[model samples]
Target: MSRGPKKRTLEVEEIISLYKKGESTTRIAELANVSSRYINKLLLKHNVERRPRGHWKRKYHFNEDYFKTWSGTMAYILGLFTADGFISQQGQTVSIAQKEKDILEEIKRELKTTQPLYRNKSTGVYMLYMHSKKMKDDLMNLHGLNPCKSNNVEFPYVPQEYLHHFVRGYFDGDGSINFKGYTIVFVGGSYLFMDTLQRILNDKLNIDTNLVTDKTNYRLFLSGRKTIQVFAQWIYKDKNLFLERKYLEFMKEKTPLDLLEDRKFRNTKNAVKLRKQKFLEQLTKTNCIEKASSLIGITTNTSKQWLENDSDLKEKVNILLNNNK
Candidate 1:
């Protein structure tokens, strides 16, 4: 006599646990190695009220094809995921933990999923979880992200056209702007990752910054008002998505005229620095700091600052002056 395959046995607790954890019924069935009907029966036995049919399909719905190509939104989300997102051992479960629920809500809207946000009361962190095998595979194979990628994560190749959008996304996740210091910073665990960012920003974009270690992690710092403003313009270029908290804070400090003037007068930072040196050197010929500053079309105080920054130039000026005396 041919015996039928043994029926897969499932416990009520197992089904309930998956359900409470936001697993869809179909996914729960797959996890439990049973039919969806059996899972539903067990849920009913435990007095778990059934949601309307197809609720999970609707709630968990998202454009799984989102990561297939390099678009602005896709690039931004990928960058955000690189910084703050986590993939499970199975590579099917993905999550983002943020201190602000508002950003999570915005990401939720963007992913087009209704997955509920969970909070860790102890840490005051809000978590958004998403489950999709295809999405995970795209991130791993098409992109270079993998499970447990924190310290070893490498900078994924991004098209030059979409790079700024990707950077904005990463910045929203692992970066910050300090209005008080007129500073912008990005923090990551991998030295290579920080180095790559510095290379791109410094060499490609003409935005300069220094890289340093911030305790266990590494960081890149861009300080001073004009630099951060220029970076903000570059990162926020497309006028699309962002972590609104950071964006709104930046707007409060920004205005059109400020940027225009920064570009108009400064021209190139190196040029400005050299021009300052040129005028300061002219102090010997003018025999007066005020006259030299006037020739440079700048305030005398500003010329003094230029001298203060260059010890060699200052020493040369002092020697010429003492010789004249």
Candidate 2:
């Protein structure tokens, strides 16, 4: 017989503990004087499966989700572009000329095919086209769609001309507005004009501009046929307005208005009040009323009014405040 049955070579428990603590199989193998394959086998024997790593979660994930709730369709379109590799989240800048060219090419390719454009079953409206087989495959893979389903079959032709017409009309229509340098193209109908515009500016432009659309009422001032003209002029005068105050003087001369009398400008004042109220509420909830008030640059009286007007909010504030005290 062998010497004590070869010491029984036991390490299953040690291997499992290391695996649970996220140690790599190779490292565990090295430490345990076993092959990586054996370490993997030990992991399998213990019924442990390694999880694939994912991209880092962003701080703005919550804010982005909230914004999406307010602008679901617009968010969907943006997500489509992102899925199609037209946009990047890494803060790398692409030239406007290059983006326009790439988008045009994508439009051309998309028009060549017959794809089932998604229709909003609830509203009886056609959503956008899926365009390519690759896109369809991606959707199938990511969303796990059944390929046999026939509800949203791909169309055979793209109707490129119709698409072009729609694009031109959509931008030229009543919902369009111009921002500092670029034209703010709004999609959807009249009821969604302001909301759509705000979402576009906030989500797309804010990445580069450092300007938050929700904080300003620029959309209100942007309307009618003159909106395009103002937008184009702004673009012509300062292509880099978002990065610098390059065209402020020029824009002021071209579109001078009484800030006090302008309804749009006045809306900004209301926004400020709302923002302060929210800041105070958050501060009180966190029990850092004095610190948050100072950090928010708001007066105590304003914070007090917000607390008094909303009794429910006041109760939350008191809890936070007392807990800290």
lDDT of each: 0.74, 0.36
lDDT of 1 by residue, 1-325 (tens): 9977646544567568657766777656654567778788888888987777756533467767668878888788889889988776642676778887887787778778787886644467777777878888888888888887888888999999899999998998999876654667788998878899999999765765766665578867775557677788888887577888898767766457255322234659788777767675667676666545544445456667867997887787788778877
Q: Which portions of model 2 show Cα errors greater than 4 Å?
A: 1-80, 83-116, 123-125, 129-275, 278-325
Per-residue error at 77 for model 1, in Å? 1.0
* TM-score, predicted candidate 2 vs. hidden true structure: 0.20
Estimate the TM-score for candidate 1. Answer: 0.63
Candidate 2 per-residue lDDT, tens place, 139-192, comes to: 344333223322222211113223222222223222233333233333322223
Q: Over 4 Å off in model 1, which ranges?
A: 1-18, 24-59, 254-325
Who wins the lDDT comparison? 1
